[model samples]
Target: MTRPHTLLLAATLLSLAACNDAAPSTADAGSLAATITDAAAATDVVTPADAALAPDDVPAPERFSYVPMGCTHRVSAPVGSTSNFRDDRSTFGAAPDPHDVHVNWPADPSSTIAFLWRTDPGTRATVVQYGLSPTALDQTAVGSVGTAGLMGNQVTAHEVHVCGLRPDTTYHYRVGGEGHWSAVQRFKTGPAPGRTDYDVRFVVAGDSRDDVSRWRQLQERAMGGMNPPDFEIFTGDAVLVGFLQGQWQSWFEGARSAMSTVPFVMVHGNHEGLSVNYLMQFAQPQSGVSSQDELYFSLDYGPVHLVVLNDTPLRSDYEGDVLGTQLAWLRADLARARANRARVPFIIATHHKPAFASSSHSDEIDTQAVRRGWAPVYDEFGVDLVLNGHEHDFELSKEVDGQGREVSGRRGTRYVVTGGAGASLTTLGAGALQPWGAHFESAHHIVEVHATMTRLELTPRRLDGTVIEAGRISLTPRAP
Candidate 1:
């Protein structure tokens, strides 16, 4: 007899088959753009991908199986359904407006910007018109339709890449195709490639899966700061179930303001099951590390080099095999970043798991693969800062080595666990604090880091806009 989950999976497959028709021509006017249609026809609707939540076509791992440890009796149960989580008029504004509209840095921020958005199925096409002036959109680019196995239904996802843009210039842009368009938004580009000395700042936070209201509050405070971040990095766990389309919709709605403008670079948390939702949401730059996946990648903004890693060792092996793929890539990536220290003086690594979180999961006691695998690379390459989440509180570890010995800012790495965004706070146990923990706070907050040629400043702020703690690290000149 077919189990309930098997029956549900079959229905989901049928739905996917039905909705896989060719999308309407995305052809617009002279340059690649989509022609707008009437407002009535382009209503953006939230649709679930499946009746019961289950993993989609999970590709085989390149080296070994990519499942969490403790292999035993496996039951094909419905993880959960997406129907429970729905967006009910909280985020986004007005009718005929696009949903889940976000920008990302898939390439050089100065010359290229990638846009992603979702609309009603069969909307024909999507396009982005951008220019120096809001009224006169001199350049237009058309988008291609991609489908993701959302909730249990197949929904249309659109993406467009605008290239050949001027460096360090402000540009106004809007998204829609065939007639329906969104309100005009503006963004500034980073400095030209191969040049350093330009100051860089970004907000980093994560673990927003459980309490979205608090997540929305923290994001608003972070985005409304005096010196707004150039981009935002989510350490991981953007939603409770990474595969739930409804949860994603809610998250996008809550943080719409911040995301619609600045680019969001994300790392995949352990909660991000199978990573189907994670992969579908954003288009990322390809790193030639693993032929199996795009879980790990890098992005450069001004003088800062951001290395996003897949810390959760989903695959197999520990000592230099299967799961060691990322460790190998990280060493090489940081080597190149360190070599170009003059051009990219500050290298910050971010991932879901923390190497030294004290308030929440005690990394001191728990044997994390990240600490075992990546910590050595950070120490060897002299990575400046390591940003991580998974602990739902704020923690600042002193410049320390793998064994928790205090190392100077010149040669040591500072680890910050800024996982207080939207998730319930975790209290520090009586013996939780480690010798390297400089500060620990139980609050809903975000972390801001300012990178300059001579120094780096880290400030942790609460959801109500109060500063929790601030620290600065002096930059040491790169060796000749």
Candidate 2:
């Protein structure tokens, strides 16, 4: 398997990695013996109510015509280590898991965090609780998941965010039916570096679907290993866009271990967010009223300034809006980043569709338009790099200047499309390279980005854990 493929598969393997009673090998693809778990955590001192069917409350599978989507984590312990994880083992005819659960840590990785999950259809009452110690869980919150009225609604979910956590700390939690609480799970908040100077590792990929593919299994095991990344980012085309809710829920359940603890951030792809379900499922920072579908926003992590925008802006033609509101906001946000320049030295832009992709449909987008509008802003604001996904292939663009020349001048913008995540590869015509595309491959893969004040490096890997493409850039915060 290639490197990106290996990394994608790691997610499934991580669940069993820690249980093998040995330090996980960064190279293994086989599953190890490990414990399994779920989510029923109420964002409170104690779970407000039990969503899972009590032992006596559960109906026999033969009684209902519904397919089973079992109960998840049960966070009923008193805010400490006293909780244990388990499963209600809900079963329907040939069903894996139902009732999609979505979660996030939006409170700036500080004292408070948030999460969302899907409950049994028509079941509104639920519970979640947490504390440093199992004996002191005095916090509590109340929320419901799914359509309480529909009989066959497969698109229901539960959402909640936890708060008041100590920085750089780990706390235990559980969620589920009151009688069958999930095994207590643990998660650590982001490290509180004194002044945003620290090193962090995150994994990148796109186009992974939950409908059971060989590539999906490979990617799952690759991403589920012991030394998992800080978080996972899906660039775009994650799946056929425009589907109703719950379509991507299993994708979330399949990678619960890594996602529950790690903040999984997603950028709107050409395939997602047409409906409120997608946006509501994944909570993004408030992008004040920008055409109701302000599918763009920005965030600050440590010293890095990340700008996420929607490249698929509304247009009657094939190209995106040239002077639309998105561009204006991009200009203003970037300008503000320059005002307090030194605090954020690394500025990156992430969108679903790429400005340049070497896949079969490379010519679909108009490059001159991007360069004409956004590239200049990147040049003016000292933007270090641009990240995107759309093509079902992996690419790492060389550092280049505004004119598409190799950049030896400054921390100019470089583009990369790491989308071999799990979808079938979209073959290119040949060794086709665009003006700014540096390295390109037609392998299923992911990207691991490591950045610091002095340098930015990217490693693009295929599903089998092979580093097909790699590149680096050097720079200081100021314009050269």
Candidate 3:
């Protein structure tokens, strides 16, 4: 049996040294490169700058690009801690006080904050009032409401985007429409984009389907920990059934502790079938990557340009290629990122399907399809890291190229599978390790990514507080 500590050491070494999988590594094959080249030549790619002129006669890619709305924090007397951190669990389901209060950055994180909440269907309106001081929350923001959940048990979903706020400052606010409002909560804005000298921390994990209690614990611990993450990133599978209103409620209830103060950057998983419920729920930045809903998009948080992809087959139930329109848009996005690498030096791509996993579902057709269609794009663009979920276990891969070859130095993409968040574990079968599999853990936990301009540090911690794997990748550049 591989003890947790030993597993952690092995994974860390493999990541830092850019190790390979169990199979014999090979160089980039000629055919795959040629295929990518041909695709590029054949497609009329759209750049971010030119995306706006997309003709209405033809379907233009849906995208939302953000520019920094710089602001200085108002150093008002800090609102008392009780007004900010008290648990609102007791007030849940009581009335218009709202349930499932969550935050996201659908617009500029520096000057805008997006919120989603649930209220009784009878509630007349959904609104948010926020400001620099708790007592003087005179500013008002109205939100739209929609119906969610299965037939006969629908709930009202409300979302708001509070614009024109200060950057890197704390603000107090409450949710509810008209006469009803919940307790005031606080959230801090992140640093402006293109600022690369500071440190950024974010929690990355997924597959919390059907395990609400465990998910609650993870949320409490993650938010309660010292210097909690700037935001939360779930690769996907937030709920067992994407269309189930009750499951969505359960997920929001479990995660409300952290989410109220931190924004959630979400992705779609196989479990998010049809994405009807998902589309109605949280609002994310539009990236023009997908003709579909918020299933695929991109956002810039500080210096990191994070691309969220919808790799699930649109017609089927989460089985297919990332080819066609999404791939072409992705290539264009990466090209833009590479051209402006100096401004945003770290570019990380995230999707719900894994390129490699040593679990029972490792060989799923969708995973293989994603590898075939998207891995070459990742390699060609020099994507720094690729994050994924879907497999119900933790597996971190070595820095492997499109052909599974171990690339040395600071090159190659590092892929990590962090699907252990509150999901049932998947034990590795004997001799099931692939050449790309560097570390595998069959436990429920979360992965913490500490990002700086020149380095990215990874630490996967079990729910019980055991550090299972730790590694660091340097983004340092060589002298000319």
Candidate 4:
């Protein structure tokens, strides 16, 4: 039987297709439409009103159906442009020297780690040497290489995966081929899956566009702490222009110190636009959505489940109903996370746009659209926190339900905008403090989260180490 929400979506899509002459062809819609249809057919029907409720209230899946009105193409460079970075050997050395090295967990965070780096086009070997001790680097992992055209410069990206690692253990590794190798860097693997006894710490920051110096300072501060982060959740906009090779080079150079050891879980920001640079630089877990795998993904670390969503969709090759497709995947993802609440007690969602913020982007169409579409799902799943960026300021919302109303105690999700990593600050607008706003600040800062099985303590700190109203949330494990 066809669900009411599915009928609404089909009607909406048909209406948009008929009225909007600029809409992409049905062929361009790809399998996403079918994926949504399949997802909807498997679930019970519910209205938007039925999904919004307090924590103790019965939960229902959110009904969100919206086709993008007019998908605007945002890629700055011409599509299908080939890279020419190797063409200029005088500027770029002929040797297969590697740079811009970083690490990510594309598989199990406890047992696997993927190393990504860039070398000259001439490089043929993609290898990583590692061991339990830096002195005895005995093991080797071989991987494949690919090419990307960034700002007219063609460079090779190498990805090597090292697995069979021990949980909560430290290992030293280096990436490169032959004579051009990077210095040995060390990283600690995550705790065993479903292990809630171990504590975890991570940093959340974003919007470092056009300010490399400030970003360098922020990275230094984040890594210089007595208890450095296990990893970083970057809210996106790593460069002023995502497609520009020089900007990315600068961004990576600034972060080389921290990124070499601490892996980054990135979100796609608007400044990244529709550039391939964003996709080429980092390796993310597959979202099982065919070609849209890298657009959104989720991972489990210690006692927390981190869901990363892509709310920034511009004109691109695979741009049909992005939010809708993500909504379907998100429902299933959160459902699984909810079922495993006994092991992972917290669900933290991160994305580029803020659903609740008092800054410049508060009233933007995309912000409101995300709020309308995803909030109810978050409320239904009892998401503990939603961290966001793109506002260029810091704002924390009181615990609120899907209807944007404050709920008693810990009955609703807390929305936080932590977009002040290194971007130019934007002041809160007049009357910016809404009833749901708990605090607002326009300073360069990063949010530190300390998570345990029973509690999560979050602190937003300035560059000078000043804490901005630390908040804590206590949790009781749900039935498995």
What lDDT does candidate 4 reach at residue 467? 80
Tell me the TM-score of each prediction against the true structure.
Answer: 0.77, 0.70, 0.77, 0.79
Residue-wise C-alpha lDDT for candidate 4, range 220-296, written one tens digit per residue:
98899899999999997776545445678888998976999998999977666535456666777766543344668
Residue 173 displacement (Å), model 4: 0.7
Q: For each candidate in the order shown, give its overall lDDT on alpha carbons.
A: 0.64, 0.52, 0.66, 0.70
How far does residue 365 in candidate 4 sit from its true spot (Å)?
1.3
lDDT accuracy of residue 351 in candidate 4: 88
Model 4: worst 10 consecutive residues (lDDT sum): 68-77
- Which candidate would rank higher by lDDT, 2 or 4? 4
- True-structure lDDT of candidate 1: 0.64
Could you tell me the TM-score of candidate 2?
A: 0.70
Our model 2 lands, by Cα RMSD against the true structure, at 14.3
Q: Which window of 10 residues has the lowest lDDT sum in candidate 3?
A: 74-83
Model 1: per-residue Cα lDDT over 1-480, one tens digit each = 113333332332332221112111232121111111121232221112222232446432222111111212111111221211111222222333567888887566877777777766545355788999999988877645444443343345566666667888888888875457777887878778766667778898898875779888878887776888888889887765454566778888888779888888888675554344565567566554333244677877777888987754332234543246777788889989988888777788988778776753554322266677778778888788899887788888888876667987376788888888886667775656778788888888888878776667788888887888543344554452
Q: lDDT, candidate 3, residue 8? A: 22
Candidate 2: stretches off by over 4 Å: 1-102, 133-137, 144-154, 210-226, 244-246, 290-294, 314-322, 365-371, 429-431, 469-480
